[model samples]
Target: MAASPSRRDRTLSAHHRKKQPEQVRRALLDCAAQIAAEQGASAITIQAVAERAGVTKGGLLHHFDSKQALLAAVFEDLLDKMDQEIDRTLADDPASRGRFTRAYVRACFSDRLLGDRSLWGALSVAIVSEPALRALWSAWLDGRMARHAETDGDQRLVAVRLAADGVWLADMMEKDGGLKRYPQDFEVVLLAMAEGGN
Candidate 1:
């Protein structure tokens, strides 16, 4: 009383059998992220990703249902990595107060978020252009903010975080790396503010 597998399902099963599903999925995601970082998100078609990943279109499809889903996965992967980086930063700090805010400042200034050549900078365009991607980013940020409210809920810390955001936005908008013009102590100042220092 069960229905037979469709041709597409059978093909996907074959592809899964040939390649480790987790490995193939990771490869596809990496390839897609690389393409987006190198050529912009507009170049991330199923064909391009499959070719870049050295997998067939069916194989890529077996991992991602569509180009949008693949893109979402790529963004999610980046977010997860960023989350880990923040945790690593926080782990270095002994103080609990403003720890999350300091990590946010550090991340905003990180090379990964500052230059157009960085993956985050490259994906910034896609995030602005894609509504779904934007929503995902917003949701992730909101969750992080909520999770850190206990330690970083002070209004002064919030302002410092917003200033860090401004710094990042200015860097993202500038082509010649204008953020470097600020005094070398800019981040130090921000970190002090993050801890409610004068």
Candidate 2:
């Protein structure tokens, strides 16, 4: 048999072996999101994500034991980021409910500035594939709607929330040839809704 591996070789190997579970998970989720954005949510898979992230199958498994776990992580990441941005936007004017709504609309439709659309697409897939995720999203939406209602009152807030959802869904589906066709018009409507108007 050959001599034992050198100390340097062992050190280097150990360094490379470090799992960095959180980093790996983030990388895998980002990769999945990118693929989803490019080819739709149906294209996301463990093998594909591993390849995109430049990690081996075993390495990916070290971070997320299964595809379902990975998908859940993706959804959690997106929702957390969205919540952070919403908080930041609302922090500027906590007293003005209209400002909060405006910020929320801007956060959602402001292009890829928020987060990769692939992540959102992955979330869309997760919602359908996993019932728990669907429940989580529904609960989150209900909370958001309740908060909006506190500010704008019941009826108007409901309309605004529905309209905002419509806008978000339309944008996600790339319907009407994407937002370019009516970005300005949509923005106006969003602002109006935020302001509790038509």
Best by lDDT, which number?
Answer: 1
Per-residue alpha-carbon lDDT of model 2 for 1-198, expressed as tens digits? 899989788767857886687777788888977877777666778899998997778878888888877777777777888888888877876456565567667666655333334356435555766886887788876777567655655565556556766666755566444555546367677677667433
Alpha-carbon lDDT, every model: 0.82, 0.68
- Inter-residue clash pairs, candidate 2: none
Off by over 4 Å in 2: 1-16, 112-130, 145-149, 172-174, 178-182, 196-198
TM-score: model 2 vs. ground truth:
0.74
Error of 2 at 92 (Å): 2.3
Looking at model 1, residue 180 earns an lDDT score of 66
TM-scores for every candidate against the unseen true structure: 0.83, 0.74
